[model samples]
Target chain A: MSGLTLIASYPKSGNTWLRAFLASHLRDGRPIDLNADLSEVPNLTSRSLQDCHAGLEHSDLSRQEVALLRPLTSRRIAREQPGFYKTHDSNLVPPGAREPAIPPDAIDRVVCIVRDPRDVAVSAAAHFGWSLDDSVDRMADTAFCIGHSPRRLNANVEQWISSWSAHVESWLDAGGVQLLMLRYEDLLADPLESFTQLCRFLDLDDTRHAVSRSLEESRFSALAGQEARGGFRERSRTSTAPFFRAGKAGEWRTALPAVLAERVVGTHSRVMARVGYG
Target chain B: MTDGLLCGWRIRSDIALPELLDWQGDDRIPDLVVRLGEVDERLPEGREISPLLQIDGTGAGLLQVPMVGRFLVRPSGGITIAPQPEASEAEIRLFLLGSVLGMVCHQRALLPLHASSVAIDGGAVAFCGPSGMGKSTLALRFAQHGHSVVSDDICVIETCEPPRVRPCFPRLKLWRDTMEDAALSPEGLERNRRGQEKFHFRAPHAGVREPLPLRAIFLLRRAGSGEGEGIQRLAAPLDIMAALEAETFRLQVGHALGRAETLFQARALIANDVPVYRLTRRADAQPDRWLDAIAATIRG
Candidate 1:
């Protein structure tokens, strides 16, 4: 039995933040270097791993081929060592495939971090260089996905991000792996309690001092400063905004236009209420 | 089975690999052989050579390639392939040309580099990198700019005095995006495989049959933030060695075949014989600008 913990989330969520916090806490309250230590939590859909396993370039693979082989490849990698991997893909089985994108047996536990859709729209708009209306439309579209660029290779595989409601619901009902749901808002509002629960879920040492220090060290302000100095590698090429932009949760109230906010709520209100975002 | 000359070696294979340029029929003994035979899904008990390759003994190893097939390279210069049940012949042939052929080169003690080359002013200029780094795309851009294509994927380097690169084939495999960017249509071209958007465009001019003297090698890299787009000469011996080693095709298999000495010799021969440079370009930079820069540098 391999031990693999997944830090799964939708795009523009707090997946990277969670990874940074985990990396800092794991290193015993060491100050996190955004570039150096970020590799501690590698992305599940790394291009090198996929190319090595598939014995061909990822661009040569069809979308379904990439989807079908991704889980098997990750399973093979997980067998080598136990570690955390971040993914933005939804938990869904491809056409004619028996397993979802992430094999259940390969993962022992999953920490799914979800953010408010309104905030996600605002951040995604900046992150992808899309207008606010377009971002909201993408969030509401059931077939929305990332990494469809035809110009160059994307670091991650083609991720199927269903509508925000469906995305949250699928992970909640994902079977086999033990699931621990965390809200990005809770992480911002109460860092100690939220990260404490997270550490407990992963069976890490949740001492108060370590958790408090890690929370302070991985604060958004600190990460933003690091990005300003060295620049974040994960920032999209088209995006002009920095990677760690506006980590506050409720800024969407001011950032997102009224019509777009209503649309996000109208489409994702059920999941929002279920996750207490409403 | 068909007979063809690939990288100056006569090859007979059970399947027709369209990527390799055709050679005149001959009675000379084949330097390599590829045939269909049963192969185990996993390699037999042996030392793990590379992540995807394993060797049980000298000159005998198994290559388990995902989605394409399994290959067993025997000491007798023959390769046995067991393709995946669902893979098409087109897909199988592509992998055979890229990875399988590279492994064969290693078994035969030849150095195969992961690169694409274009014949520039009667000399070879090679671009080496991992896949999807636009190696083939850059080569095609050179060909479109009237430079002759030398190779598409694997550049075979012979370790003779003043090492030379033998042209592999005349086709450039391109994704749909690249074809569209170049304003070429994929409507009539053969796709690499069914459902894959990649198409193979045969070079408009015939490839140079005679080996070209190695001129210079440029390692392609995407420009990082705040980094300028241009060619920087790699002068340090260690840096040049690292760049060459990173581009060695099926490097783990080469080590397992007890060719480490030969591989190191080839790297040294190339590093010392040719000037190596790192060409960094913006991801969105116009291809012509960088291509012109590379041509200007080579001409000077």
Candidate 2:
């Protein structure tokens, strides 16, 4: 059986933070280079991986064709070894495609990290350089997507995030793969507990000391310091804001406008209630 | 050997490649022979091979291209194409234009760059990058600005005393978005294939049949926030070599075919003779703006 575990999330959720934690924990006290060390958890939708399987460039394929072939390509990638992949795409099957974005049988485990849609809106707005209202509206849209750049091919796959509620519901209801859900607020409130639980889910050593050490190393300050010293490669080339901007969970109260927050919450009220965000 | 000119080579093919402009009317002796025949699923055991291609000890190799066909290329400049039974004429035509032609160039010891070029001031300037980096789109912009397109996708370079680039087909494949951006209706243009939204636009002017002296090579890269859109000359030899290596079509396949030394020699020769520049553009930058900038750099 293949050993493919996914660190799945919506955009601007705590996906990167979780990766940082896992990377630091796995390194066992070695200094973590946010850019270099994080290579272990590669993007699931990497163009290079797809190109290797397709025997042609991803740019040669239309978006629909790419989506259709992603499952097979991902399965091939997973066959190589046990590895973790980061994905922001929802679990929904692409329109007119039979299978979901991440094929069920290809993945062994999925660790889904979710943040409040309001907070996600604020962070997404900053990360993508969209206005707060625009970001909120996108979060409410059922066809919301990222990495649909018109001028150039994106390194990552076109993620179909849909709406905030739909994105969360799809993953939660996803079949076949083992699911372990984690909330950003819980991680912020108690990193040691949350990450230790995550470690256990991933079948890694969850010793208290290891968890504490990884938490210390992957602290927002550490990641921000590294980005400050040498810029983050994953940062959007267009965005002026730092990739690790404002890692606080509830900053949306002050950062996101009241109307935008209400819009996100209203749009995602049912899922928000289910996830304890309501 | 049969007789015809293909990418400046006199060749004969059993399968009629109508996409290639008929350069010979069965008169001249051929430098290469291409026939349709059975190709093995895999190369003979213990041979050097890429995932998609393989080369025997004698430089004969097989290319297993998806959807189009399996091709066996011989060291003696002969080729055998075993197209999939269901493959359409369009599919075979496209593969012949791209990968098959590229492999033939590699077998012939020519450098087939993953680039598109246009004739500027009697010389060919090329835009090179991975697919979807706007190489053809930029070349179309150049053609629209009245420059003659030297090649559409693969720019075949013969590394001589001064390397020269031979033209391929005179068609530019543009995505629907790019066509709309250029304000051209996609009404009559041929889609790259039936289902794909990419359309092939024939250049208004014919592709240059004669090889032109190579002038400048620009490696297309996405601009960072700190870097503005423009052309920056690559002064370092290593950088020039790196750029050339990055854009060489089927480089891994070339290595598998035991042509690594030949490819290296070609890269060195071209790097020494040509001025390589890095053309950086923002994702949303206007094509005309950067086209003008690239033209100015090439003219200089």
Candidate 3:
């Protein structure tokens, strides 16, 4: 395919896990290094990657310029370095840009993994050094974005990820590309079946052995153990907790405050219900 | 009189270039001429080497930035700028000295490494890495400790025996936090772009007037978890060759200019002559601690 195959999701929505699974599967279920091997599916918003493709430094560019430049760069990457790329970018057009960061023609397909916003809120609070309330508010904020560190350089480029619902709808409703929407809970409940579907969608070997061995290699315990042994590069420096913290789904029930949970549900209830989070 | 002296080249420009050093040597003719002209949207026979850049058969390149202007860089050291109406002089000069300077290096058959450098005992030591790897931060740190800043972003090197780095501009594009941490004020400094917090800090007194013999290169990298953070020299010949090739600035433009074989020889010469080290630092940046270490390593 002459376009990008995106493993797209909002932050803390099992995007890393999917990449890990794919990384192991691509290596034929070999044990993978948490830091070294994940580059098999590099982040689309990574600063170096964006700079190399755009032929300009994003640090020297304004947010508006970056917004306009991303689509052109995306098309270039689609034509040249076409393959799987992980991204948190929303499909909607950003303010002052003609199109989304990655246009439809630039995309071959998207496998979007969604988590329960309540759980996302809890995990995000730990990962971004925010409180549960702050996380919930950010998830509901229509103007929310990431990787634009105002005072310093972030490792990745600016990704326009609006509200959780807007982000979810952006990829799922996107046209002219193949879309596979999977819930994070489904992957936890049945890794074999879910990853089998994932492999098939990506045109990988979907045999039971292939799926099961890759699943075992990318099991939450193994990944978390690797992270515990050697820290994850993707972990935020400001992150208050481990990157592989609490991989289970219903942690929000115990971790999130009742008021904050209600706030997330109030804003993302429609999208949540549609994705079977209800 | 020209506005700036860059890499021993006297630069006469149609626009302001406050970030560069004053022209010092006897001026026979300007090594580079920058003129304001009506540049066309495209170049004749220009193939797109990058999103903003195109190179023609004569090795002339065109660079078009959306808000900034288009730059036509010819092999004869001529640069024509057709700037946007609202573009700031600082913004225009930034690309002229950055991407355009890199293009000029390829045109002139010089090697440009994407690095930030400072003088250590009259020899240039370079730090190369991806953006946000604190290359400029490290240079700024050394500058604070009384070392002369050699160049930032693109370090121009003559790939002769015992390669020499032509001292370029003394401007460092530092982020807001780096400024605060380095105890430098960004007040009245120019931002790299409009509404961006990154600043183009001019270190006037700390500029090196002459080229320094290229001493060593340290490829800055992050120490992953449980990994040791220190400098390790590259031993294998192929690894050194690969590192030099990887660190070359605007390598694609060199290839597009049909200078790939020359570039390969340049990389081979650098790899054979200079000692390259992989300097792994922890993700948490503490450049002050490594300043003395870098200086000592360079001296050795």
For each candidate, report its DockQ versus the true two-chain complex.
Answer: 0.26, 0.17, 0.77
Off by over 4 Å in 2: A1-6, A10-12, A19-42, A52-54, A62-85, A89-111, A115-155, A158-181, A192-278, B1-4, B11-19, B24-26, B30-87
Residue pairs clashing in model 3 are none
Model 2 steric clash pairs? none
Q: Model 2, range A82-200, lDDT digits (tens) per residue?
A: 58888987899877556876788778899998899899988888888888888888888888877666544566667677888898888898888899999999999988889999999
TM-score of 2: 0.73
Fnat, one value per model: 0.08, 0.04, 0.82
Candidate No. with top DockQ = 3
Candidate 1 lDDT for residue B275: 86
lDDT by residue (tens digit), candidate 1, B1-300: 567778887888898876676666467888778889899866667666544566776577786655677888777778899998887887777767777778778877888888999999899999998776778889989888888888888888888878899888888898888888988888888777666677889878777778898888999888765778889989887789888998887776788778899999998888788889899886677766778788788777
- TM-score for each candidate, following the candidate numbering: 0.83, 0.73, 0.97
User: Docking category for candidate 2?
Assistant: incorrect
How do the residues A1-278 of candidate 1 rate in per-residue lDDT, one tens digit apiece? 25668898888899999989988988998998887687778787778666664444666666766776677666766776568888887887755456677778778889999999999999999999999999999898877878666545577677777788888887898888899999999999899999999999988879899899988889999999999997887888778599899898888889888888999989888899999986
Candidate 2 chain A, run of 10 with poorest lDDT: A53-62
lDDT winner: 3
Chain A vs native chain A, TM-score per candidate = 0.95, 0.96, 0.99
Q: What's the number of clashes in each of the models?
A: 0, 0, 0
Candidate 3 — what's its lDDT?
A: 0.89
**Cα lDDT for residue B21, model 3?**
79
